[model samples]
Each structure stands twice: as C-alpha cells, then as structure tokens.
Target chain A: MAYQRKRICRFCEAGVQYIDYRDEKRVSRFLTERGKIIPRRVSGTCAKHQRMLSSAIKRARILSLLPFVSDNPA
Target chain B: MSELRNYEVTFIAEPNFDDERVNSLVGKYTEFIEKNGGTVEKVERMGKKRLAYAIEKRQYGYYIYTEVKMPGEAVAPLKRWFALSEDVFRHLAVRMTDRDVRLKAVTTEHYRKEMDRRNAATRPGAREGGFREGGREFREGGRPERRDD
Candidate 1:
C-alpha cells in the first residue's frame, strides 16, 4: 500500500498573515540548499501565498540575508 | 513636503569600515535626514557577515538598517546619498506602509519562533545535526519516480 501524508499550506496552517523579507531563517526553510525556491506543488504552499513568499525571498537575497545561488558540490 | 511617510533603508557596507567609521556614516545620514525634515526612528547594525556569494572578491559585508519618517520624495535623495558613499556597496530604500510595519513585526516574531525551535532541538534524544544549508543534495527537477519492488 502506498499511502502518502496529506500536504498542507504552511502559512495557512501556522496563521502567518504576512511574509517578511528580513526573516531569512524562516524564509530559508522554503528554499533548497542550492538557493532555489521550492515549487508550491512540492512545498504544499497555496498559490496566493507562494507568490508573496517568492517575491519576499528574492528581496531577502538582494539584501544578502539569503544567497542567490548556493554553491554546487558537484 | 505634504506629509512624512515611513521608510526603511537597508544597505551592505564594505567590510573594511570600522565601528567608528560606520557610526560616523550613520550619524551623517541621520543628520542629513533630519535636515530634510525626516525623523529617524531607529537604526540597526547587523555587523559583519559572510556573503552567500563573493562580491568583488570580498567574502563578507557589514549590514545596516534604518527606519525613518520622511516625505516620499526624500527617499530618492537618500538613495543618491547612499550611491555617493564609496563604502556602501549595495543599498535600497523602500517606502513602508502600515502593512509593512505589521510585516516587519513578523520578522521579529520569527526570531522568537527560531529560538523556541532551537530549545526544542536541544532536548533529550533530539537530533544533534541540523538541516544541510548547502543545498548540495537537492535535485531541481520533477517528482520522485515510483517503482514496484
């Protein structure tokens, strides 16, 4: 039997009203180590919040709070 | 100026600047803003930190954040001032709305959340390791392949 856990939107689950650009630590969780944002399908974030999250993450990267591209090990 | 609006300016300063020099620059900007009918609300110096990517072969940078109440047009001049400074490598001044102020509080809220997570992490039988920040293991493309064993 292949039973998978249901995916839920983190922001909706946590009651997070606003996504802040300066909160790098929290924002980093949504990003892959290579500094790429995880798609909403993979991350289970709603489309509306995903748009806001991506924009904020980009701003955070510009401010050096987040990396633009993580170093590749390969 | 019709009325003052809230604004936040953040910048990455050259790492070579000493505390004294950085303070002086902050003071100069504060004074300039005040002279322009803007009131500086607060300042935060995030100190030196490693850059995610090297800039001009420099691996580190100094971060500064300032919040002020000023006319909307004043931000352009402030940005120009930032550009003129040889020590400031990158800068941005964004007009802050009420929603932004509310969101800024969310940033601080995350700090509390982070601390709580750390505390829980250190508890007995908790994992000693942390998430790999390098993203070296992450694959960018599609979903996992399903295969019957």
Candidate 2:
C-alpha cells in the first residue's frame, strides 16, 4: 500500500503573513466571546503567524477596538 | 538633541471593563507619552476579541493602539508603567521610522483592497457557488494543496 502523508499548512509553507494586531478586521475573526484569539489548534494558524497574530491580538485588546468580552451573552 | 521618532504602542487590557475604565487606562498611557515630550498622533480603541489561546485563563480582552512621536529615552519609562499596571495584560512599543510609515501605508492600502475583493465576492447574487472551496477543505483536513500559489 502506498503511504499517504498529511499535508502541511500553506500558511506555514508559503509563509503567508498572519494578521497583525493593528489590522483590526483580520484579527477579529479569530477572537472568541471575550474578544480573545482562539489558539492555533482552533484557529489553524501556522506557528510564525500565530506568534505575530497573538502579539497583534494583545495589542488590539489593549487599544480597545475589541471588547474584553461580549457585552451581551450569546 | 535626539532625533524625534514615531512609535506605535499597543497593549491588551483586562476583559469586561466598562468603556470609561478602559478609556481611563488609555488616557494614563497617553499622558505618560505627552509628559515625556511625545506627541500622540492617534489613539484608537479596538474593542474586545477572543484570544488565539487562553491568556491568564481569560478568553477575551480589550485592545488599544496609540501612535506617538517621542525621543527614544521615553520608551523605558513607558515600559515601566506598563509593567506596573495590572489592567494592562501585554504591551509592545515599536519605533516607526520614515520607511516604516511608508510601508505601513502601502500595507494598509493592500489590505483595504483585499477586504473589498472579499466583500464583493461574498455579496448576495454574485458568483453563486463560487465560494472558496479550498478554505473549507484546508480547515477540515489541514491540507496545503488547496492554497493558491
């Protein structure tokens, strides 16, 4: 039987940039109810972008474009 | 005299604070910048969003962005302030040179264009059934082959 290997993530292979914290729209997608970015496993982001994404997300949180938590419970 | 440089500082605040409390924290940092001879060009409030992972066990946080022009020496004091503030969860201070400013503008423009394209593609009655098939596949199977070159 021929071996089938799992594919790597393109964002990891091609080095597609992850969203920066300053880029509000991009970071918004990954956030959870409390306005936090979901982890790599959930977000499916590559490691490098994940690092940068986290930093940016943290920055955005500090700046307040995103809420600390959803004002209205979902 | 030291050359004036633009700096962008972004930080995360504790989640669940009212607007007033969040603003007060932002104000404190802005004041620190001004007191140290830094000119604040912009102060943006990026509301709450989910963390990529749990941070201090919090699932979300408020975000703030500040653009200032100041001497290099002022950064240390600002860092110290951030360290002492419990409300601030994380912070970063980056010096923005002329090249950086230009690059930023270009990137912002590019992002804007991309956003427009995506929006148009998603509009109702437009290109029905042309949804990005690869994204779903990649999300489910962690496959790279479906990504565009």
Best by DockQ: 1
Off by over 4 Å in 1: A1-6, B106-149
For candidate 2 chain B, the 10 contiguous residues with the lowest summed lDDT are: B137-146
**Cα misplacement distance, residue A34 of candidate 2 (Å):** 22
Model 2 lDDT per residue over B40-136, tens place: 8998887786764467798887877788899998889989999899998877788777876775677667667656645644553244564565234
Q: Candidate 2 lDDT, tens digit per residue, A38-68?
A: 8776656777777767777766655545556
lDDT of 1 by residue, B48-78 (tens): 9887677778889998988899988787788
Error of 2 at B126 (Å): 2.4
Which DockQ value does candidate 2 get?
A: 0.14
Task: Look at candidate 2 and tell me the lDDT of residue A55.
Answer: 71
**Candidate 2: residue B100 Cα off by (Å):** 1.6
Q: Candidate 1 lDDT, tens digit per residue, A18-47?
A: 787776877889998788999997888998
Q: How accurate locally, in lDDT, is each candidate?
A: 0.78, 0.70
Per-model DockQ against the true two-chain complex: 0.27, 0.14
